[model samples]
Target chain A: MADASPIETHAHVLTLAEPLPLDSGRALAPVEIAYQTYGRLNAAKDNAIIVCHALTGDQHLASPHPKTGKPGWWSRVVGPNRPIDTNRFFVICSNVIGSCMGSSGPSSMADDGAPFAMRFPVITIRDMVRAQVALIDHLGIDRLHGIVGGSMGGMQALSWAANFPERCGAVLVLASAPRQSAQNIAFHEVGRQAIMADPEWKGGDYYTADLDDPRKVGPEAGLAVARMAAHITYLSEQGLTQKFGRRLQDRDAKTFGFDADFQVESYLRYQGLAFTDRFDANSYLYITRAMDYFDLAEEHGGRLANAFAGLKTRMCLVSFDTDWLYPTSESRAVAHAVNAAGAPVSFVELSAPFGHDSFLLDVPALDRVIEGFL
Target chain B: MADASPIETHAHVLTLAEPLPLDSGRALAPVEIAYQTYGRLNAAKDNAIIVCHALTGDQHLASPHPKTGKPGWWSRVVGPNRPIDTNRFFVICSNVIGSCMGSSGPSSMADDGAPFAMRFPVITIRDMVRAQVALIDHLGIDRLHGIVGGSMGGMQALSWAANFPERCGAVLVLASAPRQSAQNIAFHEVGRQAIMADPEWKGGDYYTADLDDPRKVGPEAGLAVARMAAHITYLSEQGLTQKFGRRLQDRDAKTFGFDADFQVESYLRYQGLAFTDRFDANSYLYITRAMDYFDLAEEHGGRLANAFAGLKTRMCLVSFDTDWLYPTSESRAVAHAVNAAGAPVSFVELSAPFGHDSFLLDVPALDRVIEGFL
Candidate 1:
């Protein structure tokens, strides 16, 4: 069955130069939408579901990545017979505006034929959802049977339900929040600084420069630091302890010298180095900003419920107990807001030691939740 | 009242050149100890309470540091009218053998008159405590009223109870564990590797070299990464969220450039740079190894209880709810071990948002607990 199912899906893009009105009264223009679709849309297009990827994630939700040879991040939960089954529903995933995966991001060429780099406008979670909405309109789909995501994806899903309630039939939000908390924002900031501090970064225009410039774009050291920081948030402390507890890497006794002496150290290095290959540093900076700017309530006059005022989607929110990133309280807050908005909502906190990334891992209970919800 | 009851503290050193038998069947010697004492010894010298400092801390427990203007780390809990009142009990804090603060560490001169650096013997927590025992012998203190410490300090306190149960009348451990978990060790390894990877380090001999050799010692970048990694472990996700959230550093939008745009970025930079000023990169390498080698139970045939067999010390173990570093489970394990050994033990998991550093902060409840116990 796996062999029968092709891993590559067709993708398309649309560009616009008109200014987009932002929540902060700023306008974004000349935007480009990069997206992919799986399965065929029926005549009514009622079987359509939109999947939003998290921070650092791109489109290609059900396909093998061209550069990394890894399967699409959500393949486990979005394939045939899995939750959000493609057999019954047509799925659409889009490369967010600030992303580098063929999307209009820092690497995209400006009117002057130069990479946007530091010139790209800061985007918000709502802005990302707006771009998705434009793509749906371009695809001629008036309504989605469901909108699903986790972490940053979860943020987009909630944004769709709250921003265009009538357009979404159901929303599945896993391990997300209504706004970026102070600590969450702090961690992302640390990553950004780490990348910027690298002398090779060269501002953000390493693409046009000698590529070896560390201060602008090619700051591999800083990027590695950022990746290491983010990787820690993806796993629970218990998970980390269980997987790599004080185990030395190559030597029995510490050489009393600076070396990779523990398994966790090696793992973090791999994570950092591997991440740089697939991700663009500038995109990291922009996407993290979008996440940091996300505040559903703040956009709707300080009442989260007001943001979802008149939403008509069936919402299922899932949280992982060990996910310190967007803990159970954040999920509960969303559930409360949805309930207060008089929308249909279901919320559950699952026991998973994988932290915020449990949704992407092999958690049978999470699978069950997604299966039942879908 | 704080100034009037000033204690006379003196810094002294003890060196042993002969081989000292270890549980691991190894003998290490020419070991040196740097320590300080506060207050006066009672008629029987039973009022001596050894205060062990955490990683990067030194012998200046209650007195002012000569190098840095900062007072001793545990001054709040160890001064007059404090929980472990210096007026009533003689307090002694020692710079662990593997550390840099005037102890026999990697930076100390060897027989060849050069900084030991990587040549320093791989030391363990037990070895550190053993050196303390020699110091006690030198001071003619047959028994101590208590042994107090937090984090790594707590490790030494636990070691005291395990290796010389008859020497301590009471033992108070704060924010510590019996052994380093794999995850904890992994962080230290990363730091070590970072230092080693630096071009300026000059293979631990940077101190003697006139040229800018990255390998000799000044792996500032790597050390910074290590500090950043360790700093995260010292904090709870909630604390991070509360402290920095998604706030941008100096702008309202993502720079799309490689810069410290987020407040968290600036915070981490401050944390990393500040750490290097007060710490030695080489000492970080050795001390972390000592922590990783610490296994109280393994020293007693895999039975943690046996490590503290026949102990007469009154034990108090304090844990913070948000501390993933040495979580409550670790403290509970120690309490269970002490209980099995028939020692009088008190265990409490205090509610605090500061994570592992809660013990150092002004948690009134913690003060009350210590005050009541002492």
Candidate 2:
């Protein structure tokens, strides 16, 4: 094989001229999208794939994070010879609208040159898919090879098949649900309350001030607490036990103080603190609220099967056995609905101890499944 | 029934001149225990039964909670004609050490005329049982009829049999583990962080401020967050869905802001705020730490079975099917150890959708089991 082009990210920011209508009945104007593309599109444009990211994730699918310098969130699944191989299929990933990283979000300046902040229109999964469809239209792509995602990303992939079936040839969803469960909404509510409870939040106007100035800061503590609480739900009790079972963190015995005495606590603190460095608290609130309001059935006349009626898109659904957040039962529900719709579907529940995050983790079994499905 | 003796509350405060030894090699001098007793101690003192309360629970077992004006927490199962049957058994319940209610705790005055606060030595479940043993001695009780408890209270019951086997004739433990699980400790760590993160916590010195004057406040926000996080674990995900599923609090549509639009959010916020009125934040830290440090095997040469070797206490261990906090596996582990030690042990996993708090909630099947065991 000849030497290939060095892996590079092709960035695009589409300034949609039309107002984007939202589920909340408010309209967002002049929408700008930040997206990255990898690999080459075939002459027929039949090999282009759309990749979606989970909550707290951005468009840097296979590139280094600009702020944290960490490898791309899904680098494992999108690189050469990987499940979603760059060479086999062209890939496009975009930062969701409500996110902070290079997307039109709460921090983006509005019509009057002031940050939207709390004034940003409430978005839904269908809205996010609509924005993506606009970007796809702008690229002049007739159709997509597949739409792939896990967790919240999986929700978007499902929404695409339900809302615009002709846009994609196949849908591959992992560790996701068609609707937000009551427990799911409750956790998100706690996270939002934590962000708003912070005095530094300043009603989401902290972005107007100079962030470098020590005197003015965003709600880092509140955001960190929110991250910590949400992180627990993403893992299983068995996984936590095996990972950090009552093990002291760099100590011979318990300190009996309020400090992080266990390894799990220390790890959660690091994850939370590291997150605040690259994420905006307000963005966290909007995106989670969007997720809470996502219900495929509610959007389709209170019937999940109605969304799948006469669906021609080939679909592959995979769920992790340990993922309590979006358990295998959820995957089964989707499989049952689509099967009744007479859609060609392949479903598998992969065994992985990493819980809901197994989709992003190094599960070789998942790689085989995805490779075969593609 | 002799008119039920006017439903009196026989309260006592045992003042011991001797220094109460603790697990941390520290001692509490002139220990005082606040407790309440129901029914009369039989002529032989053989009908005396000790009822241990869970964490955040106090001595008002069958009596009205003065602050919240709610009926006694276990009034459903411990009344005259109920399962525990106060008319037949003398039940004694004490507010645990390190608790804020009535007992000598972080809020109690020290010898130097200041609240103990952080100065209070961290205690263990075994230590709480030791204090109760002193109270039993003060009441001139010997060879007690039974020792019953649920959750943390259940931990105390198990410790009594393991440490002082001759003190009670029977042991009834419910919805608890012999050792706190890794997931349990992780959740507790989140709560501690939430409490300490509040600026008003003042490093556990918030109690010295004008709590009565109301000119200033303590860490109510932090404590509320802590309570909210912990409360989620007490109920099953299904229970939450059944109670409140995507229902708006008081409006027809979403608020599109940080307000609690969902019913679950409002309920969680109320639970957290109400908790701050009757609980101490510092005590939350200490008791959770004590629980995290608990390991029955560590006290018996790293052999859990050794904790029950040659035991004389008859035991009945009950677990709730839906209680993920202390699941059926934990109860099974304890049963296996006791059975191996030739202890007369009976174990059952009851069905309840209420999760960890099912032992305190309405479950008539549990009442039958407890009655038969007693």
Candidate 3:
């Protein structure tokens, strides 16, 4: 999964001419947004569909990743004849600001020529959407046909609808929540604590000139641990049971030691280690913090419906039955809020064992729902 | 929770004359078992009831903690007139091997007078029960009363019932499984990685002469992170939502940096840090590994029912509805296995929002169930 070749695409980076204001009451100068575009914008520029990536996702929506060579996280959902069909609609996915991908993040060089690291201003879901809006404005597109996202990407779509309701006509939110729950925040905190606990983290400034040696390239161990913890939440318990179920890893019996005795442990270790190679630890902390701070209802007079008051955008929310991370109840709550707001909304809870990741996995029902919504 | 005076109890340590055999094919020499006994032993000693503690628990039982002044973890259900009724039964709670309490564990001294640490042999649930059995032998108790436990303690109880069915008449297991699930092992692996990642851990030899300064004591940061991760799994998502929700941690708004902005984060941070003061990192690793290696059915021909085949001990199992850790299904599965073995068994799924910790929490229904079962 980590050693895929990069597929070429029309990836571009747009530098903001002015400083970008932040929710933290700070402004970031020289903000840059990296994005990839699939298909062509119509003559009227109204067939554009903005696809937001989830946490750890990048701009390679329909192409292979530049580093891992693996297919884009949502490659199955957005392709030539797929649900978001590049043949009919223009698809645009941009790397969020607080990410390690080719965007303005902790790993990016600052005004002083050093990596921003912890110096980078903490960003929010709305800030990410704002950056995408800048990219849209630069493309000379006044309005988009739709905005689609899953997980953190879904958060961006919801933020866009709440903050810039007129910029897009429709939105499809998949396996996401309107706000982060207390348990979700606790999980994010564990990841952050894991990352920060590593001595190699060096207070989030582990990037060095001696990059030739991979061992010296940041807190890989801590980042891997964080990834392993987070990965468990992405997949359902039933899914793990079906996939690994105390099965011995390449052995007939238990090792009776600290080594990975179960197949699940071996798989988690691999996933954790592989993640550190393509992602930055600081970016993980910042992105998770942003996600944890997301509370649409709290930001809008303590009523979730108020966030969608007088909204006109068409909304389609989809959730998987097995996703404990952002369970179907979360999506149902958002749908009820949208319904209360008198918005044209559709909600469906699809049966899938993959949990929060079912939106990206081979769930045929999700494809039909996205295609119907788009 | 970390600062409380000790309420003295008759805590005793029994050193085994012979080496104790382990599941890992290694034998531990000079093994010492620390235990606390409550109530009086009748002349026949048939009223003796052994109570096993869970993963992070000690032998405090119905007494106040020595490290923290807080009441014993199960003080709510193990007092004089409480369920398990000390007035009627001689209750014994022993610190399990591989635990950091007064027992022989990673923190215990080796033959060379240094802390065992990583040099300590890996142990298992059955190994722990074997140690407890040694202590029971020293006390001259044979074929006496019953065994009761919750979580890891419950595993010990099951192990005792299986390995020495003739020694005990009954066993009460609460919120535990016949084996550690794949998801549970994955969680334990994350915690181990977090601990091993800390530079201060110094490969498990962090013990220094300067014990005066707690900062240089050990890998407190890493251990805390591990505790934080495990703490999240102890409670139900609904329990967390009800306890903390999206509430801010003594602040009106998020700091937008890496601080604990949410109440849950703050609570978890406190829990993680507080744990470091009372627990050993290496002990945590060993205990969790022991738990991950637990599979009752695998020990007996890959059939759960075979684990209890021809068992004569009366068994009662209790599970909490909201406990995703070891949910009601786990208890049901164990009960099924016991029933299939033609043993006397009873199972109940109690309604409790505290999750896996319902056994330890103030659940009135749980109290009634325990009282009736005993």
- Predicted candidate 3: what Cα RMSD to the true structure? 3.2
Give per-residue CA lDDT, model 3, range B1-374, as digits (tens): 11232323477888899999999899997698989988878888788899999999999997878888887888777767777777778889999999888899987888997888788999999999999888878888997588999999999999988888878878999999999999999998899988888887888888765444556477888899899999999999999999999888888888888888788989999999899989989999999999998999988888989888767979999999999999888999999999999999999999989988889988888888778877
lDDT of 1 at A153: 96
Instruction: For candidate 3, list the clashing residue pairs, or say none.
Output: A4-A68, A4-A69, A5-A69, B4-B69
Query: Per-model TM-score of chain A alone?
Result: 0.94, 0.96, 0.96
DockQ-derived CAPRI band for the predicted complex in model 2: medium
Report how far residue A115 has shifted in candidate 1, in Å. Answer: 2.8
**Which DockQ-derived CAPRI band holds candidate 3?**
high
Off by over 4 Å in 3: A1-8, A209-216, B1-9, B209-216
Candidate 1 root-mean-square deviation in Å: 3.8
Worst 10 residues of 1 chain B by lDDT: B208-217
Question: What is the Cα-based TM-score of model 2?
Answer: 0.96
For each candidate, report its DockQ versus the true two-chain complex: 0.39, 0.67, 0.84
Winner by TM-score between candidate 2 and candidate 1: 2
- Per-residue lDDT of B1-374 in model 1, one digit per residue for the tens? 23547667777877765655554455655577888888778988888888888887889887887777788777877877777787788888889887878778777777787778777777788888888888888889998888888999999999989888888878899999988886676566556655665555667765753323534247676677678767877888778767776577888866544456667767877888888776788888878878877878877898999988879869999999999889999999999998998989999999999999899887889989887877
**Candidate 3 residue-wise lDDT, A1-374, digit = tens:** 11222333588999999989988899887799999998888899999999999998899888889989997887777767778777778889999998978889998888998888899999999999889999999998998999999999999999988888889779899999999999999999999988888878899889885544566478888889889999999999999999999899999988767788789989999999999889999999999999998999987899999999867989999999999999999999999999999999999999999988898899888888888888
Query: Which ten contiguous residues of candidate 1 chain A have the minimum total lDDT?
Result: A208-217
